[model samples]
Target chain A: MTAATQPQRTGRVRRVGERQEALAGYAFIAVPMALFLVLNIGTTLYAFFISVWDWNVRTGPRSFLGLGNFERLLNDDIFLIAVKNSLYYTVIWVPLTMAIGLFLAVIVNQKIRGRTFFRAAFYFPAIASSAAITILWIFLVQPGGLFDEIRGALGLNPLFAAMGYGPTHNWMGDPATAMNSIIILNAWTTSGTFMLFYLAALQSISNDVYEAAAIDGAGAWQTFWRVTFPLLRPGHFFVATVGVIGALQLFDQVRIGGGPNGDPNNALMSVVLYLYNAAFIQVNLDYAAAVGVVLFLVIFAAPLVQRRIFGSGPAW
Target chain B: MSTDPPAAAQRPPRAAVDQLAGRIPSLAETEDVGPVGDRSRAWRKRIAYALMIGYALLMFVPFAWTVITSFKTRADALRLEVIPDPFTLQGWEYTFARLDPSIVTLFINSALIATAVTVTNLVLGSLGGYAFARLRFPGREVLFVVVLATLMIPDQLRLVPVYVLFNNFGLTRDVGQYIGVILVLAISATSIFLLRQYFLSIPKDLEEAARIDGAGFFTTFYRVMLPLATPALAAVTILQFQGTWNGFFWPVILLRDRDHYTIPIGLLFFRESGGFSTNWPPLMAVVVIATIPILILYIFFQRYFVEGVAASGVKG
Candidate 1:
């Protein structure tokens, strides 16, 4: 047998094997890609389709009404309230959460005793379910509950009374404070996770920078503002972007804190909650889809605008 | 009244350094002191430690409240009491016995759904991730970008249409409820991204050897890459488990049947069905039950959780 004959046979087998390998790769990815198409991409298109129709699940018939849902959403007062409340929530919650997160990150990143314990304690709430935390928070915010007692004990009630505000009202029942109460609970629960992000970013910074700053006679505050904050840009951008997205989608806490309608003049009405209420409670599918579309546009645009303002590259 | 214009905000960083000059010689007199700078450093360390303790206490308060309240009697729960006088097991007893026996069914449903979602994510997510990471084919980059683009689309935008899609398939009813949720959460964009990052870090030399020995693509992925990816697998499993377990919005919409209710939905039902006379103790009991499993998982998998979160944050 000639050596050329053997070489040719191996070459052909190798080519066939490579082809088989490529086919296997395609096969491996097919299932996830299929699920992605049907569940995520296909349904997104279908959402747009349903938004333009008088689609009723119970009635089993639909008539096309082009841009009718969109037109109505523009004038819907409760929908406007939902949008306003969502914006309020985001505006208040994002900075509060970030500030607390950064503060805790700085603290825990220190080379001190029991730092691990401090980290674990802070992160414990982040691991617990939002439903459970909301339930606990509801307990605390009710009349004669823990929060009211604490506020009274801290002399805050007397101060409010002096200002002609009521003493120890139900925090969740009062429209003025219901949204703020949710913000407090959310900031407490989520800052732990965000603190970990800041910690990760902090650890990645080389110690040489701190040494250089110290050698330059920079004190604690100067070193923080000049070197530390600038280097944590990725952490800041990630936290802010994700925090805004999460705040805008605030639903579970609102739903549990108030009813699905976000009661008490709908002060707690978030856009997602409003969407759910319209679709399910009110059986207004088209309106719900329109609301969903608006929310999507807002959330999609927020990040791009923030990037323009911050002049930062992609967070990651 | 003297107006001090927020000295903390307006103070120069060098002010503290200047103040330290008077105390420097005294610090220098101490035999153990290395330098005046070291004394300032010690003072800074003390401040950091104090802040850490205060913040840890702040984070721990909610958790402490939950634990105490969950053990309180109904009357005690309604009152502003820190410690229940007769700390009762009646809440735990009633929650386990008095609620619908199908509360157990809800627990089982949650476990099954979380496990199924985790398994699907590991299998399908890794498959797609591997293909993206290690395989080469025509149009791969374009297809990968398309997949990644879907990640930016908000789940709320998909809610209405996905609910409709599931309704169309009759999965919103009792029969296919669990399977429907599993399908919805089957392909996690973050997990795929995480796994792809991990696979890219692995060297190709081992796979090259396997290929020379006549092993195929699937075989190399299964026998070579996967075994080496244990840490990433653990991270994805932990993150997916926590996400699926704690998911509320989609599950509530999908599983309308009482028997198919997951933990969060069941808690909501427990409140609604109980109406005005809903007992606080048992409600808190159910909340405690729901939270413990996740807390336990987090405690054990804390490292993996951090790694997974850091992975997403750094690479997103």
Candidate 2:
């Protein structure tokens, strides 16, 4: 019988289904939800409310600051720097990485030999220890290091000289180069992961579509532009938005490579990096709480608004 | 569209594979084209392969540098030499000597935590998935809404309170800190969402047969449903494992001492740059070694992981 008869056929077990589902659902999810309430939900609410006060539980006298904590976020020099760096990082890191990721995923998703190997090799960097990878990036990018040696050997040094490398800047050590370095490493490590997602989506798209496009006299470019690209739009938006969210909370590599100071001018000091400093290094829990609250608002609000605008809107 | 007049324009349309694989010669086997395809696909093919190979090399070059760096002496590392001036096994020797015992503990600890999270998520997330898929109960939709809501919260927003709660439970800054972290990682809404989709797509015949055999709800769930969900379970397992193993932020926030530090934290401690840049030689070695597990994982379970990652994106 089809779905129309599904309800009628199962009359004997009908009563049991509802009660058992209730019991089983509660039984199964009870543990995880409790963990969520403790670790996530309740904690989230507490974090928001706590942001407003001088919440020094250890130091006593939790003075009411009202929106004073949020006001401080506007004026705090390092906080401003952190915001600037985070936005810069988001701007650079998300698009470049997602583009590379989508490109690589599209390439590898084709019926290539050693598909697993290429996928895994690209993906391995993502799973490699972040701290170790950070240190490795430093060695590769530092002056007279791997990147320098390779570039020099490939006549890249001469090209860069012609295009002004030495006269322009030191890469990681200089303020300008620091965030760029982080962005480069971040893209290298992450492209494979998002590529995997793209691969899955690409694979899911039927061969019929391509064949149909060919039948319609669509060239490769036309098929890709008119069909594949538009169809992949949903996946693209998801990848882009997730990339944005992740970039805003850029903590790991920055912390590992540059530390809280970012570059000399604090050019790469990410928001979460500053949160880390406020919480762990500087022991200013109140300010950190405030930062966390503001961050929550920004991240939460941005995505919903973006989803409404981009994902929801008809393509131009 | 026919803007071409050069000798290059005389070439034939290419196999789609040729576009992604530059090495492939003009393999136009069929006469399939319109004016849009009048220009040789071979040119586009050439461009695509060049881009793909270029990207692959860019991805690999740094990693190759990291490997060579891992073999360098501390002095060699400092000098920025391309090849080690006189390479020593000292870095590897030192990494192993310091690493073997403590890192083994961290590895095992990490494995146990990831495994715990994976197993718990597989059981709970899928059960919840199946419940949502097959059985309707009061407020089941609302419960799901609550679960999905948790996905939107930034992880850091929950950290302070979870830290406080874990502290109260005596799981802080000490040995065996995995308890707090693993449970937190396990309760992901996206996993549940993924598993439930797979489960709902299941045909009802198997369960109906089991019910006919006089099976109770738990019996049918355990015997019939659970075993049938191997693919989805495998996918969720690998995903959760990756999340758990590569977890840095939570681990960094909770665990203070070196002994308790996971591989990520251990790498950080070992690569202490000390008022300058990092000791990337040993760090790269550690990066390679640390990634071996994830590599091993992908080798065995890539089919599952890739599919799961793909499935989790839009569905997640």
Per-residue lDDT tens digits for candidate 1, residues B1-316, read 0122222233233344233322222212222445786887688657866876877787767667767776888778866667887889888888777777365887898999999999999999889999999887666687788788787788888888888878888888876988889999998888888888778877789989998898988889999988877777888999999988888988988988888888888887776675522587778877877888888887887877776776677755
Model 2 scores what on Cα lDDT?
A: 0.71
Expressed as tens digits, the lDDT of each residue in A1-316 for candidate 2 is 5888878768747776667767876776677667666666788887876677776645423788888978988999999999998998888888898888877776676555555567776776776657767877776677776677667767667778886686224677788678888898888888887997776556556567766776687755666678777877667777877788889889888877766566557776888888888877777676787788888888888767777756672231
Position B69, candidate 2: lDDT: 74
Candidate 1 chain A weakest ten by summed lDDT: A307-316
Model 2 spans with C-alpha error above 4 angstroms? A1-17, A57-61, A109-124, A162-164, A167-170, A200-219, A308-316, B1-51, B78-87, B99-101, B273-279
TM-scores across all candidates? 0.90, 0.84
lDDT of 1 by residue, A230-310 (tens): 988877887888899999999999998888899767989999999999999998888888888888889889888878856
TM-score of chain A for each candidate? 0.94, 0.87
Which candidate tops TM-score?
Answer: 1
Clashes by residue pair, model 1 = none
How well does candidate 2 score on lDDT at residue B166? 69
